[model samples]
Target chain A: MPKNTLGEHLRQQGMSRRSFLKFCSLLASGMALSPALVPRIAQALEATRRPSVIWLSFQECTGCTESLTRSHTPTVEGLIFDAISLDYHHTLQAASGHAAEAAREEAMKENFGQYILVVDGSIPLDNPGFSTIAGISNLDMLKETAKGAAAIVAVGTCAAFGGLPKANPNPTGAVPVSDIITDKPIINVSGCPPIPVVITGVLAHILTFGGLPELDDLGRPAAFYGQSIHDRCYRRPFYEKGLFAETFDDEGAKKGWCLYKLGCKGPVTFNACATTKWNEGTSFPIESGHGCIGCSEPDFWDFGGFYEALSRPTGQTGKNAVYGVAAGTAVGAAVWAMNRAKKEEAVRGHEKLTMDELNREGEES
Target chain B: MTSTEFLLWVKGTGFTLAIAVFAAGIVLRLAEIWSLGRKPDLAEAKGNANTAGVRTIFNRFIPDKGIWDRSAFIIIAAWFFHVGLFVVIFFFVPHILLIDSIIGLQWPGLPTPIVDAFAVITMVGLLAMLFHRITQPVKKYLSTFEDYLVWAVTFLPLLTGYLAYHRLLFSPDMLLAMHILSVELLLVLLPFTKLSHSFTFLLARWYNGAISGFRGVQS
Candidate 1:
């Protein structure tokens, strides 16, 4: 069966080698690798054995998984998923209860220190009863599964940054995968549900490079998180020109002006949404006439309000400007009045200078 | 601090400081000038002072034919520079943004290409004015070290802004900081130097018109 290699598997599925190579190049571009590396990526991917990927779902809505699967049919992302041997995914796998657990344990032992651990959702530590896989709590299962894994990919905001589950007044005591497993090299693919291509890109990088890609300060792949949404946004020119839509459905909005005045967080938020986009490059949030909710950044939920403009000052700025103008006006007005009074007094005291007085003053000088 | 942090300081603490000094200094200087009032004319009355004051504001815009030959270069250059400066100051996107932030009022900006042309014109006009001042006999006699200082302060913001936008000479943060710092210097010096003309030009023109009108003849 020629070892059922990726190249062999694709050939058997009736995919041309050219199509497979094109997919490899696309992945290379997504990872910000030079075009010259395309051939190398193709060669490496085709010859390589499929790595076992164990996807764990804890306190999540399965949105991340759905985003990965439902975006497009027969696409590069789907193909990459097909190429990898997904040994354990509770939702996707037909194996139930004991069988699923057995598969995960068997994969960990068989591919020990080589298998990749992909996690969605945060781990609940407050109580073992909050979430469980079979009879095991999420915390125990994650900790157990993390051992012997080569690396962990935190696949959603919840897994990456304790997202909605860890928002203010959190009840589940949900902590991100990084907090629980500090020993593993964790890459965060963070969004409410991360853009699907971003997930595939991370997987492709690991599979081809045999190591994790370079990451930013937040543990997100730098190729995707390198620029702010504002820097790459189509509406940036409008922002620079100080043209803004005051409200949704206003004339300015209809004219496609900047949404800065209507509380766009594009300026501060960094993600690939502006560049990579969602639903196969159809449109991003700003394109649909809505401001960014800053889904990728940490603690985005607590940034006051989504509709509140970022231009609005938070502290003493307003008071300071008012005091400045008032003090300035008062001083100016007082000085103006004094000057007027002096001018009036001078008028009152004025006398015509005769020729005799001018001659006398000149002679004295 | 990092470049971004430095930028934040300029936008926040630095901006407020400049505004305070600019506002207060302008008031004080204008007050001082206005306090030295002139005596009323006794020989007057063909036209009202108020009418003449308003008339003079517009009248002085067009120079008389007699003195136009000697003062033509100065007047034209100064006019060009002043108009260019006005356009650059109030119409540039960044400048408008700053104004919006401080006052909560905002308006659309001109196209970038137009703003760029105005900036170039302003720079060239300022250079021409400076050249005329240093070379001309009468203007040279009037020029002082303080005048040169004011000129440098005025020229710096525009130059640094150009460099920053084009990403020349330094990093983006450093260039932006330099641009801001130059503007701050200009704001602080405005009342103390000849740049006070920005506020005083109208008042001076009004006074001249009123005094001439009081004499019942157009001077």
Candidate 2:
């Protein structure tokens, strides 16, 4: 069972060493590492054993799985995904109820404290009956499975920040994997469904380094979530020129001016969508002439309307600003009136002085 | 605090405080100046005060021939400083955006590279102006602590902004916070100090022009 390493497996699959090295180089660059790190990454991945991965799905739409599966054709990313010893996945595995559960159990037992646990979607905590697998509640299953996991990959915004199910007044009382399991190193690949390359990139990083990648405040890999979308957007020049599309079909929009006035969240949202693109390097939301909805940010569902400008306050700040202005104006008026009275008094107290009197005053000084 | 938190504070609470102070101070200072109503000139008026006031606003921008020649370097450098400051403040996209957000009015901005060049020119011009102020005996004698305070506050925003744009000194968040905070410092000092000249200069020029033009002089 421990005989064939990744290098041997790649050779058996008829993948050339040159192609494998090229793949390593791509991964290295995608992860924001110098090209010099390619050889080290290649060596690390080559000598690595097939990491046992256990995938769990909870309250999700399965869009994340679709994003990965339909992300690209038979690319190296897919090949790497295939190379991992993925022991359990409900949609992908061909086993029935008991057989599937048995597969997960066997993999967990065999690779105890070593398997990578990948999760997509939030888990319902209010009611165990809300989401379950083979009559086992998702919460129970996650807690049980996480104990043996070396690390966890929270694959979608749902698993990372509880997504739509965990939006305001979350009915199912959904919570992210990190909320439930604090012991394991949770890597959040956050997006609406997350970028496929980012998912594969994080996996490659973990496989090569045998640890988690450097993360931002939200537990997202810093390499991918480092910069805001506006920084890399092609239409940024329009923003700098104060050219903006006020409406969706205005001349500014046609001219591809900045969508900032039309509720573009690109300025605030952090993601690689602008640089990486989607659908095999096709256009992203901003490119398609639509504004970003800030889907990657936590609780994006409640950041006011999707078409509301980001600088437009969400009610509270506006009222506060108004009050502040009123208070300031009132205080200013009072101060000005007092100062004016004092000046008038001083003016009234002034006495007329002729050249003779001024000369005498100066001489006394 | 982390750079991100520091940035949030600068953009949020710090910005709010700066705006409140600036608006209130400007209003108070303007009231003080306008309330000092000029004593009626008993002498016969030769020209219209309204036209003279308006004319003086633009006229004081130039000096009389002899004074212009005598202080040519000061005039040229002053022109550079004012023009450069105006362009950097009103024509830079970020500054324009800030103004638009606050006032609900928007205007086109100059190209980014032009604004960048003007920022550099403004910094150099300001430094040269400051050097002149300190090194020249007459100006140096008149200069006070407030002069240095205003200069430092004005210079910091430009320096920090350039550093932030090039991502030189610190992380992006930290640099951006420094830039915004420096601007806030300038704002807080604006109405209380000689920077109030931004407002008072107009009033003083108008008063001078009106008084002179009333006597049939093109001041």
Candidate 3:
């Protein structure tokens, strides 16, 4: 545990009280808290000692790490790191070989049952050799590290929901961090590479409250994942108005119509993309004239094709329709033939003495 | 299953089955009607049956003046419900895409707010119609279980759709799945119930007009 409080550490690092308060306000807003809570967050964060964070990378492409490094304004690597003791991250840590492993063990031992464990990749269960850190299998490392963690933050879709590696024919038997460590409170920041502020926001919430944030059914922080992209989308009016871009180069596309026809998954995908946006509030995927691929949702990779609309049938609809029409035609024709035969039979059986028969039938009745 | 998996199932297998049943039932019913050809009239024709039949298809949309006067509320409510249903089904972007996928034709849809307003109107109209059916003594006697069943099925799609669009009561995926499943139910039930009148009413109108035309009377 750090000796000085977060405010003292930031002050020592040349950060003013006003700037720290501003950062707290940003964090409070990012966590979906009301403006009134900003002061409480500031007070809590200023007085609290910085928490120890142990970041572990397993079967990942380091996109999560890259996203974090590029996080908004205050710069996560610069300010957040200054606030927390990121004891071990092989990519960012200077120590290599045994030295890096020693740092992780030291942090775990020193901050036993208090450190925050942030994992950014899935764990491979097929074979220990598939993924190893310093000769330790991912599963073994996760199990060992989770024992001392106060809480765990699964930082990406891979760590949260067994992302691409666990997609269709999951060869490596890849599983998420939650699958292996269910005993601890797990906060899933799920996305192909989750938004930058979301990551910091979650961390800031933990720092301010000294506990995990409220989560959704999927174990994601409800503050960020509460609303879907479609609900907050700017182009939603176009969708409501029945205006869509049939093709990428169409007039609707040029006019920035809804991308539902182009297979936008905003309706089902829960994320802050539409509101928080990406790259310093530049724009999200939908704003770039491309439909959202729903990277944040679980098993997004296996939800048929990316360009296929959410309402479109996943099966061979055309062939099934053809079969339906053929069967219908056959049945229709059969019924038609039967009715025609019955009519012809009646015609053939018609008697010449119809009037006399009718009189006789009437008399009998 | 997860909501997404449920959504996929409804969009895939459920949709296919509903379409097949709807298609077969429609075709079979039409074939049965066509095979029962009308007997040729021995009397000389006073007017063109074709012209009269086509005219009635459009003209029957409005009820006779005396009937309208006696039950103007019912007539107006029924018309609003129908017009609203038509606008929502044909002018909504998502519904249009579904239609285009099946029929290989596309048309520009009305704005979303317009369609949404129309959907609300349709629901209100349907409710008024139902109230009239239940309270009006003659209509209540004439109504059958099938009438209420068809009404429920039609109302479900609209209600579920509105809820899903607004993301109410449930998760977005769950709401969406329910909306789609409701539509599937409507499609499957449409052919077997009095809802088949959507197609059969045209034939009935034509027949009535043709008979009137043969008698040299305006219908």
Top-DockQ structure, candidate number: 3
lDDT by residue (tens digit), candidate 1, A197-229? 888889999988889989976799998887778
lDDT of 1 at B33: 74
Model 1 Cα interface RMS deviation (Å): 4.9
lDDT of 3: 0.88
- What class would a CAPRI assessor give candidate 1's docking? acceptable
Which tens-of-lDDT digit does each residue in A1-365 have in candidate 3? 99999988989989888888878777777777999998999899889899999999999999999988877665543576677899999999999999999999999999999999999989999998999999999999999999999999999999998888988789899998988997999999999899988898888888889988899988999989988999899999888777888899999999999999899999999999999899888999999999988888887887667887787766666667777777878888998888889989999998687788889999999
In candidate 3, which residue pairs clash? A240-B112, A241-B111, A241-B112
Best by TM-score: 3
**Least accurate stretch of 10 residues (summed lDDT) in model 1 chain B?**
B2-11
- What does candidate 3 score in Cα RMSD to the true structure? 3.8
Sequence-dependent TM-score of model 3 = 0.85
Per-model CA lDDT versus the true structure = 0.81, 0.83, 0.88
Where's the lowest-lDDT run of ten residues in candidate 1 chain A?
A310-319
Q: Give lDDT tens digits, candidate 2, residues A126-178.
A: 99999999999999999999999999999999999888998878999998898
| Candidate 3 per-residue lDDT over residues B34-105, each given as its tens digit | 878888899999998878987899999979999988999989999999999999888887787777777677
